[model samples]
Target: MNFYKDLEPIRRPIKDVLAEQKLFTNFPDNWHVVVADIVNSTQAVKTGKHDDVNLIAAGSLIAAINAAKPFNTEIAYFFGGDGGTVIVPDEIVNKILSGLNAHKINSLKNFSLELRVGSITIGEIIKAGHELKVAKVEIGKGYNKSVVIGNGLKYAENIIKDNYLQDKESIEHQLLTIDSSELNLEGLECRWDRIKPLTSSLEVVCLLIEAVNFKNQSTVYRDVMIKLDEIYGEADKRHPITMNRLQLLTTFLKFKKEMMVRYSKWKIGHFLKAFFETLIGRLYFKYNWKVNDLKGQEYLEQVIAFSDTLTIDGRINTIVSGTKENRLRLLEYLNQQEQKGLLIFGHFVSTESIMTCYIENRNDKHIHFLDGSNGGYTEAAKELKPKLQML
Candidate 1:
């Protein structure tokens, strides 16, 4: 008898063959999966101009990828005409949400594009992919959108996995059952959590991945702070703070402080500068107020006049001293504004002295200082708009 002839024939599982399909080549184990579909692709193709639709689709995809990257997500596969999948890490959940929110807002505002995003954990992917034939059967019944099943079929496997059943269920429910309104609420909470002093020190770094992306550090920082304040104020109005809540609040503040310091070298200064300038511009127009040496005074005056507003007793105090003196003068002006019913202030700082200003109600004094170190008055004015809106 020939020993070779007696050997049993080699058998390979069908599941193994399917898993090796070209579409699932980049699938990673132990990952978080994100599937994003462009809403109304068929309509986009039928009624929309090809160029316009392409622009919208390209923008949407770019935004999604940018948002996902900060969360440590790797792009698994993207079907050009429909959707894509991303594998995310657990640590960057907050960043992912921030990116997604920013992307969604921009897309809606610009192109009326909508995206539906679903995320799951790695363990779920493996479990779902265990029996490739069964998973394929499910896909055949219109469940190809399932990332794990797609992976098993060698289509696209970008499923998220985790050990916590409750967490998984919460995420899944959020993805499937929650509407945009519910997402907005959750998003607001997530934003608050990022900037709260309690969590600010948690080292939640956002990776900037797009040239036109909207995740400005200063803007995010300011918005989160505002939201947290809103939440805390509401909670305070309802009940005396429990120790746990107070502790959480305190932690959030600390975390925010830490994040500010850590991300100081980023474009935050530019954002701050822009915020101040925009505010000044608006106030100038609103009250017909002007700094003696400011360049845009005429244009701003026109704006005020067009809006049917006139100055109601505003003062300008120019400081000749250095930057420190300028800050003191501005601070002093703020205090004086608190005393008077009307206050409007503006100044341009030379290299030797910082140019900035503040306006306030006599009874509701608020101080605003724009550092000359950041930019000149013109540049600072451009930066100030968003900050004013925040106020």
Candidate 2:
């Protein structure tokens, strides 16, 4: 059953969403928390492989979501720039895992990136003395984001990391050859050039924050969000993507690189087809023309509204465009919180944000992923590591 789909969307502000525990629903015991991470992602990003690392991470979510589509299932998933986590029902777990396993193999073979895959049962999480609660918030006209509270997910991640480090996980994973029909990353796209802010003086910040105590997570997040708004304006004002300035970057090399994982193989012929399609896409957006009854202007608006700007899964992860002065103001509040033992945060600043997208449909079924160019969340988390050690 699509439990997530049935949950009522929280219509109030996020602060209200956090305070209303009554609105939070229990995660079904039959479902699971599946996670996959790229090993040594920091080192990989350091070598100018941020796009590669992010591509594989996005693929992890794509493969899993695409697999579920056949079964008419909707899953709640998170993209971490390095890896991702997904919540899925029991019936489709095996098939989703098959796609993820294939993704793992493809990752290693194609990019020399080692991907670690694992899963933890929701029932097992409940038994371990932690709670897993989920809430849905509408981000746009037809898209909703999953907000997970409590320490259960953090507990599962810890277990998964430990097991992976010890080489204790026994996973049966296979590769997707050209002849196989199991894995599909057809919706994944990276044609956009690095997105610059509309404001010439603004900077893109990739931020991550974690609460010290599980019990205070929701409230702490509420406060952080409120403070961010006071300093940076609303989410739309601070969103890193600017449609007016958005540009496309497509080359034969990019096409080849993406296809290596997208189709499990690349061909010069496919690039030619894509090259012509990009030409048409450019015309559509440039002239605001209607294609198949979908206007480019409307699609771009949806893109702005549906971009994954914030993700809360026992932590706060977001990308925003703001001035250096305003960023300092936001950081000031976060630093005070760190001193007061409420939360600790990490952030990286860059001239523009990197965008990777998954477009199942241009009309209404697409999501864009953003990160600061160079190294975004990965670098921010690196800055957060020593602070974590102090904890």
Candidate 3:
């Protein structure tokens, strides 16, 4: 019953975790990988709606999370800038898909963006000779993130995407046709304003890295983490979010945007209630009120503590803040690795960071997602994909 939940958290340095294959176990055959992405995200980002793109991607995880809650399994997921990937067992796949379809419909009606959702079983990927090595890594302050090594995710992405391309019209029809109104995004909050670095000298960089040879992935990624630890210091030294920079967005416009996600058809009464909640929230955070035994200051610490600043899903994707000098050194090291044909990387720079949060349980269970305000990982990918072509 504890398929996903009971895995012991690995507290070793992430570098060591990646190198120890025995630490990552194979996923069960009955499980499936669920993937979702906004179609035409490149053009969408150009229009300055990267925030919307980010939310839709987060939606997939939230919807699936809500669906899986009853089954009592902690599904592991990755939130890419434009979309996300989640893995769930077969017992709840239908309910999960239904919820995702509902979210897709909401996305089209509100943002005019097409969200494609699909799933492929682990059995099939294993049949095709790919591996799905997974583990839960404890980052700090009792929070954990799911890390994956091996080509399993890459193989699933390729197949799901190819299928979408071949059956484009079917996807469109399902979006309009699937009528599932049971999407409970209860604690999905995006109220924070864009977070600026603690100082003007620091800039946010969204970076992506992958090994060239499949077999070298373990060693290559291990080296990247070791290098990052050297350049960035511990995670706290270069964190983008700090207590002083945490401010709730109390604008009516912000409420209206969130309303579209919680309600399919808007209700003014509900909107007013939410607007008042934001007003009250502003004071709660400002005053550091101990409402319901949860401290605002302490919660801010956990927000930084639980933030998805670094993620490894057969590749390394991270957003961090640092001086230009530190960034240059990182690039220099990465370039040297690339020249050796050990790895390839892509990165984009921006002025500040933005956050979208999922806080189902205020005290114990929650995590925050961050992106560079401009484009984050998607913008970084523009550089990364071109490099892939020459290979």
Candidate 4:
């Protein structure tokens, strides 16, 4: 089913679907689920390489999409802070894996991060006795993000990690000898500087929560969102991204490096072109240039609109900007929820958050990604694992 069209009918929060069990449908058995996350991401984040970690994670999505060549085929993807998950037909799994291998290699050579990439089949997930149910969440007009609402993907992630731990040969053997010279990463950009909260005393919190029961997970998540509103106001009000906060870097080194990430290498002419483009970007941010019916202000709003700030992919995860007091209030609420057997939660707070953009256009096709500057989601995910495993 087409996610864009099908998700239009789903107007309620996913909690309704989880309660009814009718909104999610089984994925085709021939399809494969691909997951990639940076190994030792915690260390990298601690070492002050969080942006590289995020780029690698976003790059994984680019790798799979480029390799699959799914011009008209339907694909589903979810971006975690450290990496992401992509679902594609088995017919293109090998190609996608090879592209992932290229990404893994590039990440190591360029940024010194080891991206662990692997895939598993729907049959294997079913045989493991965990359900895999898929649905789409509509975020904007004709825009949506696919969500998986069962333990099957979580199981696959664990198995893949186990394989990475035990079978180095098989993992290495899966790396193909294909040429990735023409890597496709058309929509990704990181022009904006880090975003500090509106108030100096505020903090950026990244968190993940999983309920003890799948049946109650959505309800618990809805409560958490409600609590956020009560404390921090609407999602837009809590968002850290804004036009005044946007800044374009003019450093030649950063310009060259960013260009190289998209292109294998560049000539003098390419460098000059990129330099001019960077200037134009600065001008646009400064002058509020309209791109496809959206000024800088409207564009920043769309950036927040399409972000994965709060998401539910087998578990609820969020990267929010708020005051320290509000953050503590939410934590206390979470502890109370944990006490009541509603959910178990983990969170880490940082002084500032970073944004990365993937603008297919300034219109609804654009999406922004955010993570706390120093050890954001990686640290939160680490704290979450022990609790998630116990469930």
lDDT string for model 3 (1-391, tens) is 3677888999987888987888988788989999988888878989989888887788778888898898878888988888889888888888888888888888888889888888999999999998887899888856878998888888898899999999989878766667756767767778888999999999999999988876668889988988888998777887877889888877776777777875656769867876787788778778888877888787778888888898888899999889999999999999999999998899999998988888887786787888887888889989998888787
In terms of TM-score, which candidate is stronger, 1 or 2? 2
Sort the predicted structures by lDDT, highest score first: 2, 3, 4, 1
Worst 10-residue lDDT window for candidate 2 reads 170-179
The sequence of per-residue lDDT tens digits that candidate 4 reaches over residues 274-335 is 67877886776678898767786676666667876866777877888878888888888889
For model 4 the local lDDT of residue 369 reads 72
Q: What's the true lDDT of residue 128 in model 1?
A: 62
State model 4's lDDT: 0.74
Steric clashes per prediction: 38, 0, 0, 0
Report the alpha-carbon TM-score of model 4 versus the true structure. 0.90
Clashes of 2: 0
lDDT of 1 by residue, 255-365 (tens): 232222222223456445434555564565456574654434454322112210000000111112223332354346434543442222233332321111112221122
Q: For model 2, how does the per-residue alpha-carbon lDDT over 1-391 read when each residue is reduced to its tens digit?
A: 6897688887776767998788788989989899988989999999999989888888899989898998886898988878999999998888887788778877777899988888888999999899889998887777888999988887888888887777633443223232245668888888887888997998999999999888889899999999888999988888888788787776876788777888778777878877887888888899999977889988788888888889998888899998999999999899999999998889998888877789988888899887788899999999887987898
Model 3 lDDT, full chain set = 0.85
